[model samples]
Target chain A: MKKVLFLFVVLFGSCAKLDNNLYNNDNKIKEYKLDDYTGEQDFILDDSYHIPPGLVTLLTLPSQADGESSSTEIKAIYIGDVSKINSDTVLLYCHGNKDHMDFYWQRAKLLAHVNGKNKYGVLMMDYRGYGLSKGKPGEKGMYADVSACMQWLKNNGLNNNRLIIYGFSMGTASACELSANAAPMLPDKIILEAPFASVAVMIQDASQLNMPADYFTDLKIDNAEEIKKCDQPLLWLHGKSDNFLNYKTHGQAVYKNYHGRYKESILIEGADHGQVPSQMGFENYLKLIGSFIRKP
Target chain B: MRLIRFICIFLFLIFICFCSPTQLVKPLQKGQRAAAITYGGPLIKFAGAPIPIPFTTLGFSYGLTSKITGYASLHTTSLIFGNLQTTVGGLFSLYEQENKFGLTVSPAIQTAYNIRNKTGFRIWPTLDLNAYYHPLQKPSFVYIGANSWFELSSLRAHNEPQANHIIPNIHAGYMLVKTKWQHQFEIKYLGLGIPNLPGVVDYIGISHKGALGIYYSLIRKF
Candidate 1:
């Protein structure tokens, strides 16, 4: 018994000292400093675009895990009137995995414009390890960052009845994370743009093989599987020619498999991954989104 | 939900191991050879539900010298279309006592390929320390062992992190004695470890909980 105990200790003790890099493969997350070149004041809209005035920058919001506060604080932007947030509809726009808010400035401006030119509010934030947020980006960390932002909006009198959630590209994972699982509060509706089913499905699509789940990162943000549990109104928009994430395998899969009360999808022909809104025409895009929001 | 999916996969891998035949616990004499076929699966519990998946394997061992043996095996899931793993190993006896107990150490390397469509490959290096006790009868004996493996290769290209590298397994079982037959049933377990590298835990997001398995085997000696 003593020998067995000693052996167990030796074996388990050695594992704790093993290198950390051995387990992670192809985790190509690029963390960058916040782009100070662009600011709230710099977002001047052209005649084609509509800009909202409040455009306030949220300095830092705390991320909590298991009820303990994480050291990382997130940065975000609110592109609407703070006073109108209580009365008007608000859209929390979760952006894709890229540089930061600067990369998504146009999308936020467009979403605000989509919301009847500042009649509604648009909120956007950088997940931890993305922009000015501290700490590395974990699945839970990003979830916590988004949750903090949602909590902040709720604290400011933005309720679920007037809140819409929109996700684009990698941000779909964060959006699905909130919806498939229970949050502090649910959204009135969900909008997914060029969403992938899951990381495994995406890899399989990329590699063109029936790879198993947990094949790569175990980052099981399986939107296809998770969406079945969400019972909210959903709006899906995708380009027919999206090369990065195939519309049929990802977007259509999620939409087709969604067991929601109300759901709709729009597939624009000849539009690629990043050019859906452009190809669909801004006026038409606004009309579709506006109808979804104003629906009884 | 993510946690449930992670647990399901982790447990499935253990089920695959559970279906595999036991490695040669007793060192073979010169000119002796043993071949076996195994079948088993895991009883998995997740989200208050139980799931069992079938697994199978074919294994063989040959004695090169009085105290050394070479072994190899092929294993798959559901008889087809999930994953296929091939393993090669050598065992050298360090100590032996007739009608009593013996000790041996084995070092093995294994490579697994997914067979569904595209080929995904991973490699693991394993070391086993085993002890066998023979009270009076030679073939009807009991054994205990532990195997530790470090993942040396991944399915993804370009140094992306994979989940759980140091796989530690423990086993114990009794052998059913027969002249030309090697039959055994064993209990096995693979314990989970913490993610030591940056980006590993974030990507894998699996808790450090181990899996328990039940295994059985039948072999022919020549």
Candidate 2:
């Protein structure tokens, strides 16, 4: 009996030690320093154009896992008037897998401009291991990162009815997970641009073979199951000409499986993955978004 | 002498309680097993951008339980597409009896050598812990457990010496076969910290590991 108890203690102690080591080895917090900087800058509007803008104040909000002693930091960018953001409306943007939030400064500025007059404060966050955020990027870590950001918004007086989540490609999974689990306080609407059904299914479609998606089971986000549970408004945008993620399989599956209050699927004929709005004319896309937001 | 005998008897009783014959009967009686192989290519980053390198993997696994019996395939990546690379591993389980449930755990560990080339090796060690429930005529079960893995290579392209990371996983799979051989699917969440690097790259951490696969196995009675 004593030996058995000793074995149990040893197992439990070893697990705790391993957890500590993982925390100690992570150096996310020591990376980049965030500050409020306002300066004239050169911005790239697209592949072929550069736009100059007046001085803009960039505030970097740091994020960390709950109850951790280490300094792993995640970065969130708050642009425009912080006071304009309230419990009625806010735009929370999640960028794609590559690059940091700094790279998307131009996009963030554009989003804020579109919102106009600080009517909707735009909050863009970096996933762990992306940009200046600390810690490794994994399924659990990403979920935690998203949850932490949501909590931060809530602490600052934001709620479901006032929140709108926008995700691009890989970020779509995180958005879906957050939306499904948001529950009693779900977001008002969710937008997935060029979304894939699930990492596993995406792989299967990409390979075009009979191989199973078990290898990706480790990275699986199960968005199909998640989307079914989301009862809020859902907007799925996919370009018909997209080659990276098959439109018929990924985006269509999501649109088909969404059992929500108001679900809509928009197929941009000549638009590619990231070029939908620009290719089809930004005016139309913006109109669609504006109308959705203004809908009573 | 009397004291030693008493101690021995006490240990024997405890062992019997935890590892009773009833716990080992059902799944072993059923003959159930299977294996599969899967391949995952290089993970694509930006659209229209060049993929650093693509990979191909093959895997095999088996399992047996009271309600379901099956095995699995061990390969580099799922038969899907993504940037992450996995080593190899398998599992087996038992669930179903008039009044009992059973489980087993197995794990695999692999490494990613370079972001450009996408190469690495793995070492996996597993453990299984399960529980059983009885509701009159049948037994329904639930399980919670962990597995540990060690990455053996560096993640950098230049072959810089990298710190080894350990991932702990927890999951629950249902038993489809009898108490001996069963069919099961488990969901595990992987967590590990980031390695020390530089700049924005430093804050980029990798810690999520999850999988959905089937398991099959066969039990032998002694």
Measured by TM-score, how close is model 1 to the native structure?
0.53
Q: Against the true two-chain complex, what DockQ does each candidate achieve?
A: 0.03, 0.03
Candidate 1 lDDT over A203-283, as tens digits, reads 443322233444334355778777888887999999887765778767877887788899998999987776777787777
lDDT score of residue A82 within candidate 1: 73
lDDT of all the models against the reference?
0.67, 0.48
DockQ-derived CAPRI band for the predicted complex in model 1: incorrect
Model 1 lDDT, full chain set: 0.67
Off by over 4 Å in 1: A1-47, A50-53, A67-71, B1-222
